[model samples]
Target: MEPKHKRRVRYKGTHPKKYNEKYKELNPELYPETIEKVIKKGSTPVGMHLSIMVDEILEFLNIQEGQIGLDCTLGYGGHTLKMLECLNHTGHMYALDIDPIESVKTKERLLNKGYGEDILTIKNCNFKDIDLVSNEAGLFDFVLADLGVSSMQIDNPERGFSYKKEGPLDLRLNPQKGIPAFIKLQELNKNQLEQLFIENSDEPYAKEIAKNIDSYLKSGQLISTTTQLYKIIEKSLSFIPIKERKES
Candidate 1:
């Protein structure tokens, strides 16, 4: 007998609050209509990254056929794909990203689209080490570096980049390299936490937030998830009105 076919995952309501639960948005190719609808509503689909300022970037670079191009940050390969198109499959493009997981997935995705070894090369390396890449590939005719946290990184709950969803408190760009945020949080003292809040994000209620987090730790409660930390922040600023606190 043939193996049983599983039904598609069903969400409780019209909207999916969890990032992983967004099955349609995750698979954009298989559900173009849903993707289009999400885009039309001025929201990017989960697990899909729309290249920003595509025309503006192309205009500035003025990439030509048979020219070498370097993409310093290949998040979802959207910009890389466009740059490859500008090369018209004649020249080669080299892309680098710190995210080993996403970069490998993107390499396979581009290969499927016919951008093989001859046309595209992707490496799981930081842009800070561009000299290494340049040493191998030589000088680039044009370079594109769209810097910022990728939406894929921010939106994925498992990546732990955002507090909007509950997930493991791991926030490293390369999850393999460093200790997780949860570990880091446990290590820092109250004063260090306050300084970190101010120095890192310019948070005004740094002292209060840090104090509360310290309190939880002193009580032997480990803050393990994004939501757990988010609640601690909320409680710290509970005195602020709803409107102002919401912005925080």
Candidate 2:
């Protein structure tokens, strides 16, 4: 049998210039393309305010270039914009929200900020569907799940998330996706209400709150506004602590 020729081992010096050039081709944003344009032109939505803990969030995540991230709850895109500043042009940021309205707002903001090219992908979907979205986009380097309603949604009276406002009791972040808060209250029994309060708010007076809800339902006193609910909750519980009272 003829002896097999030795396979040539490729060393850094032995490699062709094309082989070294491939690295630059793979990461043009880092090597050749200017990332300053992307960072310098970063924009925030009108009236956008970041959370107090944004710096802490960034520190914990330790965002780096060429890293993909997901803002699971793209409230006003404050965190999203910050992450965009940290990411390379090659890095992708996926901002997901169930509300079509917010999605539209975010899209407009991103377009104005010059992220319309491909750095960001906005999806109108729930957090549960993020895995599917990420799977399609490959895994993310960082994933931010800012659960619950955003300050903007809560501050906006039309959304009906604030007890201070007397808007329609429509607390479904995405009004088209789930039943409104009023409808949900109408459907829920006392036990269900208690369970929801306990699970979500961790209120100790959940049972009492549920009893009050039952009483209101039985008396035909349909409470269809956040203000009405707030009054009911306030009246039901008297000695709640400040922290607990705020939640109530």
Top candidate when judged by lDDT against the true structure: 1
lDDT of 2 by residue, 35-66 (tens): 34333566322123344478889999999998
Report the backbone clash tally of model 2. 0
- Shift of residue 51 alpha carbon in model 2, Å: 3.3
lDDT of 1 at 214: 97
Q: Which residue runs of candidate 1 sit more than 4 Å off their true CA positions?
A: 1-22
True-vs-predicted CA distance for residue 104, candidate 2, Å: 1.6
Best-fitting candidate, measured by TM-score?
1
Model 2: how far residue 241 lies from native, Å: 9.7
- Tell me the tens digit of each residue's lDDT in model 1 across 51-155: 899999999999999999999999889999988988998989999999998888788888888899889988889999999999999999999888877887887
Q: Worst lDDT window (10 residues) for model 2?
A: 19-28
Would you estimate the TM-scores of all the predictions? 0.89, 0.72
